[model samples]
Target: MTIHFSCTQCGKCCHNLRLPLSLDEAADWIRRGGDIELFCEAIPWPVEPPQSDAQAAHKRRLSFAAMCGAVPIRVIVTVVAAFDGACPHLLHDGRCGAYGQRPRVCRIYPAEVNPFIHLTPASKACPPDAWTTDKPVFFANGQTLDSETSELISQSRAVAAQDAQLKERLCAYLDVHHMALANEGFAIHKRAPDVMLAALERLKHDRKQVAHGAAATWRFVSNRLSTVDTLVSIGADTAEVSSLPNALVSYIAFFPSDV
Candidate 1:
């Protein structure tokens, strides 16, 4: 089936947004006085997911591998420009203030970076009329038909892989080691502006120094004690969900069945 989309300038997508950004874009965001939110989740490795190799490859492309105690895992860190109300660059005239220099994610709007996630207009915040426009063809035959959108998506994935390792190290400096299980939800860590910018600066300038070296281990946290016990018994490091009740970090789950 073909999908057609044209933004109605309603700006719903721009409000209460946590737009994903590249490492450099993240630094630029903070420099422009925007906040950085690290949304982290982990996938158990060699405990091996039920997915096919192709599905696994997609996950690997977007995640950095790390160890959670004796259990191996892959970590995905989504560096987001977490803003509320409206994007700082969204103009009152319903235009983008930083249009030319906007992040790739901004340009790839209404399209997903993950190939597995098919674009569904009803699932989006856009008004119904946005998809009723007669001219633009966004997707067709279950694939993105817009060459520019396709290219941007490719670049987004490539940059994600390129930034993976460094992002993992950045997390260490910020003391962000806890993660929600893959597909369960993300443990959101909101960093102080000074601390985050400093880490990103260090990431920009230094590449060799490791954080925690071979000693750093990530732990999973779940709301249900039974899920915590299940992971712990399997040698996956874990922590109580209630242990963190502060401004810096929190967990948001997609489903209550994490237990």
Candidate 2:
């Protein structure tokens, strides 16, 4: 299905929005003379570690499976800080300061909802205020995923850069958790911190034995990354479509058989 909508530049989409950046994206912002601190406002949330050996094995496999697909996934969650009082780069007059080079997350606003059986009212309304939709979009009623909308919302190179950043962050997050597993009274296993750390380090080292170079890098390197599942889970959805305003505006499915 196709969706159609145009932006009137009402600036509503700019409010209460948290545009996250991958490490590369943030770095690029700095390189381009944008404030690095401004891009650092988005907070990273913790991902719980596997509880047991069996679970760890299972999760490891899952992580690999999840990463197999090529579709880029990244989360630019809306945190209070990022949305504190309108983005610093957002002009007082409603224009984005970094329009020509705005972050990927911000560029994808309004068209950012996920694929779900059910959608909240808040989720439905967010897009229409600054844009429109035309597909069987769950969040926005009567909206269809029309070609025009799709064209406007198509992914860009900057978004790909953000995806790479997400990978770096995830690696770092796992490393920190691996360390925490060594605590003496750590609730997970009551294991001694030093002992567990030693064992984990060994395991980490062994996993690097040429055979699993990619997996090894994933474990040893600290990185940032994003995925559609994680992004949709964290972002807020408008409950219903807001009235048309003077503004500009902006999924996926199971695998299909080859023809």
Best by TM-score: 1
By lDDT, the best candidate is 1
Flag clash pairs in model 1: none
1-259 per-residue lDDT for model 1 (tens digits): 7888887878778788888999999988888778889999998886565567788888887888889988999999999887778889999987888888888988888888888899998878888888874949888888888899999998998888888878887887788888998877789998788899999998878767654573357989887777789888989988877776577899987767444
Instruction: Score each candidate by Cα lDDT.
Output: 0.84, 0.34
Name the runs in model 2 displaced over 4 angstroms.
1-4, 30-81, 117-259
Model 2 TM-score, all chains together: 0.38
Tens-digit per-residue lDDT, 1-259, candidate 2? 3334455677766765445554445445545443322111111223435567663433232222112122121222111123455766779888988798776656555555222222333553245533345424422353425444444334433344334333333333223111010111011111233333343344445443433322211100011122223433444111111211212100011222121
TM-score quality measure for candidate 1: 0.90
